[model samples]
Target: MPSSHTSSTSRAPWRRHPRATVLGTLAAVVSALALVLALPGATSAAPSSPQAPQPNPPQPVKPGEAWMGAGVQMHEGDSTDGSVPDEGRRNLVASVHGVDVSSHQGNVSWSTLWNSGVRFAYVKATEATSYKNPYFTQQYNGSYNVGMIRGAYHFAVPSSSSGAAQARYFANNGGGWSKDGKTLPGVLDIEYNPYGSTCYGKSNSAMVSWVRDFVNTYKSLTGRDTVIYTTTNWWKQCTGNSGAFGSSNPLWIARYASSVGELPAGWGFHTFWQYTSSGPTVGDHNLFNGSMDRLKVLANGG
Candidate 1:
């Protein structure tokens, strides 16, 4: 009266062969599932794999606009034929040709730089503590009078120098950067010295902190952003990680190669490109900066 069916353990045929039968059933189900999966999906209308990206078509520049190649172009607005020199005033018939200069090695007179068809100039103003330029006096004022747009650079010290003190030393010590909260901002030069030593040490982290300290302090004093100059090495080692400063801080990248295309990627914006070391020297010496026609945009706060 309790139950008619017995447990599989009590049934000889079912219990002894249960394992094999269950295994066979599972195999059949798996094979059926495999066959179903092998067929196309229910939504078989989907297209095939992605098509290759289409190449961008070339386009011509509008009248009065010029292509400087390497993705730089410019438009010289309508203006009177002024006293900006016949050469500087000429149309941008070529790419943005430029060269960096330092008071240390540039030997050409300002007029020579102006006549050489160069555009903008960045002059190194200061070096690490206790090392300052002796020739910047003439170079700074020369670039101004020659109508060549100019900027200043500083040899940055480690943040361990006390941020405000480091900035003050360069700002007050005839570094030629603007002191009255106006004029072009400063540049913090951060790179490895093959045979030299620095308070910032050889670590890229130290260099990043030093750059931030120097730039912040300079801005505190001058009410303007300071530029940071370096190359692919320093960027990878330092700025790429910190992510504090904006790309708009007028980056002066030192890439002395065949072209600006050789510069590394991931840097969002580059304001200045130090393209050559063999251009007109300031005074028979190797200077340390560059020139760019589009630098006028930086000057005009573009």
Candidate 2:
């Protein structure tokens, strides 16, 4: 989950001339005195009754905004009191519904998920040169058995390991692809680093090189382009808005807002949109950018 910390700065009142400041203070005092005098005196002066507490003002709502809680960020539409309407779900900006999961979701009920209208799934396969999801086998195979298109993703650790090494490890473990129409291409989950610095303390060019290495290695192993999963902020900050992989790799964008907003450089459109992390489904809610037929073509290595 991404941190939603926001900071605000207050500027000191400008007083180029001291006389202006004194005049402003005098005016404020006069207004305060007038307001005080306008209020009526307490009638009869009996035992004063306690005043009722005023209700707090409603907070402003942002369309497609998400609240962070319970170690996950839940979109407003996916909240318990605010579900995406059936019409909205059926007619989402992106048509096909899906989900992405990891060991964090524990043992998932793939059948229940399929029944709930999940057409595809991306399961976490590996992180860096180590850390394979313990439940990868069950989650990967289970989704496929339940008739959902399945794919695997690697959590990128550009700071600690060479991208090629990590890619090789991921492919060997679960990121490999086949001509089978049910399997989607492997994904590279590269976003905010969960470890240390946001950019993994690397220069923008280094980050781009790292990503290219990962994609190249994965492609060599699978004979299919790796899907690049990222957020707009991360793409700009870490990769310097490079679109080197845009032509070859499909994009899986994460945005919890109502609108997709501006995408990274290179890609004119996104293939996958992860709209919410805590949805009715047991993982991140997503949408394939097209119809089932297009998704099928992608799965078939088109």
Candidate 3:
């Protein structure tokens, strides 16, 4: 109801000069748009699609080439892939087909492996004391859920820490075992030192002692002797062909040959043989060296 002069005087800055205010607002909007286009990961180019192409992020080093038969391939110069396993060892000694996997093969399709006659699997759980396979839960539990008897293995790094300490780390992380008829005893993958000299620069007797400590500690923690995974050549080179663990721990021999040739001194025969790096399925293929009943017996702490 005020006079026009009084109303004009009381008008806000924008209302008094709407054209100038609109120009200022448009300038601010253009400046902001310019700033956004100037920033990294955004460009001033014409719109190519609904979204800009994101740059490929850097990938962390994956544990792809360091599991199971890696030592035989690295140190001893042996491989059994694509070679029919001496015309296939299923015809020679082992019957039950199995597999071993690591985080290298992420999120395994275990149901596919199970339906394809793989009755057992070993998943790498820990490396040294520091690394735990990031895909451990999926690989381990997935294999079990699909009715495959699965176990966990620790890749040993003796020089980094004591055997007992590494064993503890392994157990505390993912290498635990129970008599649930589905979980096999944890395995100690003590093969060639992938980091350095083959024997970890330890004397033969010292190497033997290190393995003994790891085995003892794992047994104390899980009430099960760990399955020892190694090549006959590596066992001889590192432990001086020590036959100490043969009787107590089951052997998971890594030999990519038609037959599981010579075993380490202690083990009369291998319970599990990693026969090929490339199997018919996703991971390394192995043989359980027995029937399904025998595999269950091992799982049940037999």
Candidate 4:
């Protein structure tokens, strides 16, 4: 989906609330004063002893692989994948790499994609209630045939159709998941409306209710939580910072910058990050947030 924003910063695993930071600072000060008071004959004017060596704070564990430039590996064919050669791959901050596609990409060569080190794919299946991608079957099956983890996504249109109706349509068509250890859970693409108003003219509460309806219905049918594909701005503007889905749904964040940026409410970390739309493969380029083992666990419905 086309996004309105451009730049974003890499996000930390946890977003500390401003109130929490203030309280933590005050507690530290109070604890230091109490320690001094407990010492024998200690006074505020007493000479300070050499401070104990403080251990370095632990660094956030990054993905297994570091970000590399796009041209690290290249193929001789035309950029049929919408991949932005020598550009999209830079500043990558994730471990595993993959691609997502739709009819807009035309016919993709899945084998070629796999040969280029693509490990997974998310093919667009349906949009709203009536529109289904014409090339969904070939794209979805072709990725699987090429031995890549595969999944399907639905583009949401909450104003035009009810969430339950769209979820049923998506599941029945191609978004359903199987425990075969190859298929990933379905994705709900809920971002810029792409039609009229940004939020499809729905209030934040209504939008949140619609999303809940969609995910709940999808879970009832497939027995798996749907992955949510969204940008931080859209989530905040449309959903009013709701954390309802954070505990249950996995996040697939979209940001076309050097960093992942602050995420929506609820999610501490994103499972998949759609870093760039103009990747060297097809459609959007993404990273699985962990190692191949974790990817397998996700595929196996863990």
In candidate 2, which residue pairs clash? none
Q: Write the per-residue lDDT of candidate 2 for residues 242-284, one digit (tens) a residue.
A: 9787778888877765655788998877788776554312345
lDDT for each candidate structure: 0.42, 0.64, 0.67, 0.64
- Residue 207 local lDDT, model 2: 96
Off by over 4 Å in 1: 1-96, 159-163, 174-183, 194-204, 238-240, 261-266, 278-294, 300-302
Off by over 4 Å in 4: 1-94, 279-282
- Per-residue C-alpha lDDT of model 1 across residues 154-226, encoded as one tens digit per residue: 6554533655566777776554344322235566665533222422353555656666677777877766666
- lDDT, model 4: 0.64
List candidate 2 segments past 4 Å from native.
Answer: 1-94, 279-282
Q: Alpha carbon lDDT of residue 139, candidate 3?
A: 72
Those runs of model 3 whose alpha carbons end farther than 4 Å from true positions after fitting are 1-65, 87-94, 279-282
Ranking by lDDT: 3, 4, 2, 1
What is candidate 4's TM-score against the reference?
Answer: 0.69
Scored against the true structure, residue 279 in model 4 reaches a CA lDDT of: 26
Q: For residues 237-261, what per-residue lDDT tens digits would candidate 4 score against the true structure?
A: 8899899888788888876655667
Best by lDDT: 3
**Candidate 4 clashes between residue pairs 3 or more apart in a chain or in different chains:** 9-261, 10-259, 10-260, 83-279, 83-280, 84-279
Query: By lDDT, is 3 or 4 better?
Result: 3
